[model samples]
Target: MTSLTIIDLSNNRFSGPIPPNIGESIPNFLYSLLSNQITGIIPKSIGYMSHLEILDLSRNSLIGSIPSFISNYSYLYFLTLEKNNLSKTIPKSFG
Candidate 1:
C-alpha cells in the first residue's frame, strides 16, 4: 500500500506493543517482525521512519527500553533486537 517496500511478519503468535502509529501507518516500509510473539514497548513512533531500511525485532517476548527514537533511522541498514526480554540499558543511541 502506497508503494510499500517490504513487511514480513515473521513466525506467528504476535502479541502486544509495536503499534504506536507505526511511522504513520507504514511510511516507507522495510519492517520485519522477526520470530513473533511480540510483547510490550517498542513504540516511540519508530522515529517517524525516515525511509527505514531493515528493522527486525528478533526472537520475541519483547520488553522495555531501546527507544531513543530508534536513533532516527538515518536510513538504517539493519537493526535487530536480538533474543528479546529487553532490560534498561542499551539506548545511548546504540553507541
Candidate 2:
C-alpha cells in the first residue's frame, strides 16, 4: 500500500468511523470517502501524509472540528468536506 497514490471509496454505503491508523496503512496522494455513513473526527494521522493533494470526506456523518494539522499539507490543493457535522472555523493557514 505504500506505493499507492490514490484511494476513493465514495458512496459505498459504508458505516463507522474512519480508522485512526489509516494514514499509517496508506499514505497516498488522494483520498476520498464521500457519501458514506462514516462518523467521528477526521483522523489526525492523515496529516502525516505529506504528499496528500486531494481529500474528500463529504456527505458523511463526521463530527468535530477539522484538525489543525491539515494546514500542514503543502501539497493539498483540493479538499471537500461539505454536509458533515464538523464545527469551528477552518484553520486560517488552510486558506
Candidate 3:
C-alpha cells in the first residue's frame, strides 16, 4: 500500500493474514483485495510477488489452506477465492 499500485481494499475492516512484511514496503507494487473483513492464511510471502498479476480474494473472512506457495505464481492470471471462510484441500496444485 506504499504509494499504491492498484490496491483496492475491498469492503473494508481489513484484518490479519497478509503481512510477511508486505514486500518490505512496496518493492514494486500490485494488489486488489476484494470484499474485506479478511481473516487469516495465504501469505507465504505471496510467492515474492514477481510482478503479481491480478489476485482477487473474493468475499472475505479468510480461514486457512490455499497457500501451496500459490503454485509459485507463474505470472498468475486471475485468482479469486470465491466466497471465503476457506475450508481446505485445494492444493494438489489446485487439482
Candidate 4:
C-alpha cells in the first residue's frame, strides 16, 4: 500500500473526509477524486506528499480554506480544486 500511486476514484458516491493521512499513506502518486460526495476540509497532511505530480479533488463538498501547504508539491504540474468550498487566497508559495 505504501508504494501505491495514481489513485482515481472519480464519478462515484464516496462520502467522507478524505482518509486523514492520505499524504503519508501514499507518499508518491497522482491522486484524483473528482465529482464525488466527499465532504469536509482538505487535509493539511497532503503537504507531505513531495512526489505528487497531479491532483484533482474538484466538484466535491470539500469546505474550509484551502490548505496553504498545497504549494509544497515542487514537482506538481497539474492540480484542480475547483467547484469546492475552498476559500482564502492561494498561498504565495504557489507561485
Candidate 5:
C-alpha cells in the first residue's frame, strides 16, 4: 500500500525477521512492532522509508548494531528499541 501511513503490529507475539524490503513495499510514516517475538537484525532497506516518522520495535529479540543510516531520516521524530537483544552503542548521529 503506497498510501499507507501506519503499520502497528504491537504485542502480536509474532516471530521472525522484518521483511527486508518493507520500505520499498509500504514506505509508511509510522511502524510499530512492539512486544513481539521478532528476531534478527533490522533491515537496512528500512532506511528507504523517506516519510518515516515513528518506529517502535521494543520488547523483541532483535540483534546487531543499529544501522547508522537511521540518522538520515529527517522526518523521524520518535524511535524506541528497548527491551530487545540489540548490541553495540547507538550511532552517534542518531537523535
Candidate 6:
C-alpha cells in the first residue's frame, strides 16, 4: 500500500501484524491477505520484496517457519501460505 502496485486484501477481515514495514513499503507488487483474520510471524521484512511476483498469505492465523528468505526472492512465482498456523519444514526455497 506504500505506493501501491497490486494488492488484494482478500476476504477483508484483517487482523494483526503483517505490517512489518511491508517489504520496506511495497517494493513491487502482487500480494494478498487471503481469507484474513491474520495473526503473527511471516514478517522477516518479507524478504524485502525485490519485485515479488505473487504472494498469498492463505487462510490467516500464521505462526512461524517457512521464512527461508521466502524462497530467496528471485522473482517469486507464486507462494501460498496454505491453511494457516505455519510450522517448520516447507522451506527449500519452495519449489
Top candidate when judged by TM-score against the true structure: 2
What tens-digit string does per-residue lDDT give for candidate 4 at 59-93? 99899987887887788899899999889578788
Q: Which ten residues in a row have the lowest lDDT in candidate 1?
A: 86-95
Q: Summarize candidate 2's per-residue lDDT along 1-95 as a digit string, tens digits.
A: 77899899999999999999888778899899989999988988887889999999999999999899888988999999999999967989877
Clashes within 3 Å, all models in order: 0, 0, 0, 0, 0, 0
Record all residue pairs in model 1 with backbone atoms less than 3 Å apart, i.e. clashing. Answer: none
Please estimate how well model 3 matches the true structure, expressed as its whole-model Cα lDDT.
0.71
- Please provide TM-scores, in order, for all candidate models, with all chains considered together: 0.31, 0.95, 0.29, 0.91, 0.95, 0.32
Of 5 and 6, the candidate ahead on lDDT is 5
Candidate 4 segments whose C-alpha is farther than 4 A from its true place: none
Model 6 C-alpha lDDT per residue in residues 21-57, reported as the tens digit of each score? 7788677678899998999898888788888889999
Please say which candidate is ahead in lDDT: 3 or 6.
6
Candidate 6 Cα errors over 4 Å, as ranges = 1-4, 14-28, 38-59, 62-72, 76-83, 93-95
Q: What is the lDDT, from 0 to 100, of the residue 92 in candidate 4?
A: 84
Better of 2 and 6 by TM-score: 2
Better of 2 and 6 by lDDT: 2
Which has the higher TM-score value, candidate number 1 or candidate number 5?
5
- Report the C-alpha lDDT of model 5 over 24-90, residue by residue, as the tens digit: 7887999999999999999999999988999999999999988898899999999999988888688
Clashing pairs in 5: none
Candidate 3 backbone collisions, by pair: none
lDDT of each: 0.81, 0.91, 0.71, 0.86, 0.91, 0.84
Clashing pairs in 2: none
